[model samples]
Target: MKIVIFGGTGFVGLNLAEVLLARGHEVTLHDRSPLPPAAQRSLADYRERLKVVQGDITDAQGIDALMAQGCDAIVLGAAVTAGDDLERASPARVLEINVMAQIPILLAAIRHGVRRVINLSSASAYGAAGQRHRILDEETPCDPVSFYAISKFTSERSVARHAELFGGDFLSVRLSAVFGPWERPGSVRDTPSLQFQILAAFARGEPALLPAPGIKDWTYAPDVAEAVALLIEAERPRDRLYNISSGVAWSALQWGEAFAALHPGLECRLVSPGEKTVIKLHGGDRAPLSVRRMADEFGWRARRRAPCSGRS
Candidate 1:
């Protein structure tokens, strides 16, 4: 199969691309940014199966053209993972990319007769509901407070509605806090992963300062990629909305400590009351997302082999 991932240069996009390529599928990564050097090196072995294109996600014409080139499936991975700072600085741009830009791509996919469309949503879409509930499922009512959350929820509904109206094989998967390879600070993604920050701090010979345990149902990027691949390849998924998550909660401090043991100069510590750290948590830790739907339907589950155990 031939697949194209919007925002393919981003963290999860790159992971998904590698997974698809490994499965013997041709992939095109269309994004506003060029492929990072590290990702380029990692994917060098699959050069024959992968193509990277630099273009704006909002360009309807470009989307149509890409699909016209014989795309079997399309993954909507472009998004502005905004926080309070970015929301305040550029709210419209956030909506433009995360919500409004999705319609054009979906329309193009439909027109080109793409077999499947997978929308990569976020667990942040749960927003306040995530805080209120200990477990979030597809049926949970969402009360998104942040612009990023609002946009994600809106995008999910938009994709679902499009599928309903056009009878297209389109679905949305709400992903939990994703952290793994190819994750780096970028213009659109202001919130860097705790793991990234910890490794970075150690590299600078400074302790990884944390405001709290930074606990949540963090999912690995590779697992997420595999689950999404399942969705795209599934003959017909039973539900329009699903949650892709680790199904267990863990702390950043635990992960940091495990890493510190391997590195001589590394340190991970809690911040003192008056001390400030550049590391920013995405939001107050929320409850874990339930992966029952994903697991039951596709027989997929997150790999919990990371040292970050399910300890308070």
Candidate 2:
């Protein structure tokens, strides 16, 4: 299969690209940024099957031209994950990138007769509903509170509406907090995963201090890549929307301790009662997402981090 991934230079994109490439699929990575040097090195073994194109996702003609070249499937992963400050400063840009930019790509897919389209969504779309429900599924009602959340939820709807009107095989997967290989600081996203922050602390020889336990069902990126690959290759998925996650909740501090175990001299612990913390957490603890649908549909479940379990 031939696949094109927009936002392909980003964290999730790179992971998905690697998965597709390893599985012997031809892949084209289209993004505004050039491929990172580290990722380039990691993917060197599959260089013959991988192609990287630099372009703006908002450019409709550019996308159409690429699709014209031929594409079997496309993954829409371009998004501006905004925080409070970015949302206040550039609200329109966030919506434009995260929401509006997807239309032309979907249209191009339809125009080129692409077989499948997957929009990479986020658990942030759950918003306040995440805290209210003990286990979120596709049917959970959302009350997105932030601009990023609203845009993601809106994007999912846009993809579904396009599919319905055009009779296209397009679906969106809402991924939980994803962290793993190929994660790096980038321009579009405001929040890096807690695992990334903890690793950064380890690199600096500083203790990882927690703002809070920061518990949630944080899925590994590689696992996420595999789940998405299943969707991209499946003959026909029954559902229009699905949630992809580890299916178990764990705290950031626990992850930090797990990392500390690997690093001899490092420390991972919570802050003093009133001490200040530099580490930024997305929000308070939320429930883990249920992966029963994914398991039932594709026999797919995220790899576990440890023995602890809940909500799988």
Candidate 3:
């Protein structure tokens, strides 16, 4: 399969590109920024299977030229993925990148005779209303708390509407708390994984500390990438939105313990439960993502056997 991933240089995109390559799919990474040095070295082994197109996704002509290359599928992974930061920062830019920018891309996919197009939406689509449900399924109502959430939800709707109009094959997958390889720290996204922080500390020759521990669905990046690959290759999807997650709620301390055990010398310390932490677990609600539909429909499940990756 020839798959094109927009924002392919980003964390999730990079890992997805690798997973796709591993699965014998031809992967193309389209991004404005070139691959960072670390990603370049990490993906060096798969150079033959992967291709990078450095261009502006917001430009219509650029997108047309990209789609002209002919692809089996296209993954829209480009977006500003922060809730509070987007709310505080440029909210309009959030819609511009996440919502408005997707229209042309979707159209281009339709025009290119692409078989399938996957929009990488987020669990943020669940928003603050996600707090009410202990488990969020694809059917949950999205109460968008921030523009970022609104943009993701709106993009999903826009894609659905486009499919309705053009009869194009398109799907959106909602990913939750993804932490793993190729993920880097930047102004675009602020929430680093507990596993990521610990790993970074180990790299810096310091102990990893979990300030405040809580429970949330922390999905590994490679696993999530595999799930996306599964959907991209699916001939027909029963649902428009699917959750790609570990389908488990793990606490910071629990992760800290296992993480430390995995890396013998890496020490991880967890602070008191009441202290501030990376993921703010609201009232200790383990709002795990419901992957039953994905399993039942696609036979896709996240199998985590290695240490989760992330950046600081």
Candidate 4:
């Protein structure tokens, strides 16, 4: 398969690209930044197996050219993630990257007869369900609380519309906190409260900060990439949206304790939830999404363990 991936240098994208490349698929990565030396070296090892193109999604001509390369499928993973302070953020740019950019690229994909698209949506779109104990499925009502969520939700809707009009298969994976290797340093990695605390402490050789006692699921990036691969290869396409996450839930304290156990030499401190700015995590109480739909239809499962689970 010839796969064209948007935002391929980032954490999730890089993991997905590696998976696809290993499976002998032709991979082309489109991104705004020049490939880092490490990424360039990795791709170089693949020779003709991989290609990286530097282009802006906002540029219609550039997107069109890439789409014209006869990609079998497109994966939209580019976006300005959450954690930006609204005061210094450009809502226009945010919307441009998340929502507006999809228009031209998707249209070009359709024009070029691309077969499928897997859009990376966010769980944040469900908003502060705050102990509502609601199970958020594909049909869950969207109450986006932040600009990032709003943009992602709008983009998913836009992609659905394009899929309907253009006669191409589109799948939206509403992802939870995706963590693993190749993590970039920015809002995408830091926005999650637990990760923010872990990364900060790891940087300083201190303990991670824990959130208030609450349950949440964190999906590993490789598992997410595997789920995406199955979605791409499914024989019978189903709903346009699916929640990709670990069915199990863990409290913030559990995560910290687990991490401390893994690296015994690291000093661990559990901070009171009161010391942290409290933003309600959107999806915790919901019953685990039945992978039966994906399993029966496409044979997808959570293939990776949680970070602190101490399971390889």
Which of the two, 2 or 4, has more TM-score?
2
Which residue pairs in candidate 2 collide? none
lDDT of 3 by residue, 143-198 (tens): 87668778999999999999999999988999887777777767666656666676
Model 3 stretches astray by more than 4 angstroms: 262-266, 272-286, 305-312
Write one digit per residue (lDDT tens) for candidate 2, span 1-312.
Answer: 999999999989999998999999999999999999989998999999999999999889988999999989999998887788788889999999998999988888998999999999888899999879999999999989888999999999999999999999999999998888888776787788888887788788789898877887888888899999999999989998989999998887887887787668998888888777678997667788888889999999987654222221
TM-score pick, better of 3 and 4: 3
Candidate achieving higher TM-score, 1 or 4:
1
Off by over 4 Å in 2: 307-312
The count of residue-pair clashes in candidate 3 stands at 1
Each model's lDDT: 0.88, 0.88, 0.81, 0.72
Expressed as tens digits, the lDDT of each residue in 83-151 for candidate 4 is 656414676777888899888888898899988899999877776542344456666577776688789
Question: Would you list the rank order by TM-score, best first?
Answer: 1, 2, 3, 4
- The whole-model C-alpha lDDT of candidate 4 against the native structure comes to 0.72
Over the stretch 24-128, how does candidate 1's per-residue lDDT look in tens digits? 999999999999988889889999999999999988887788888889899999999887888999999999999999998898888889999999999988989
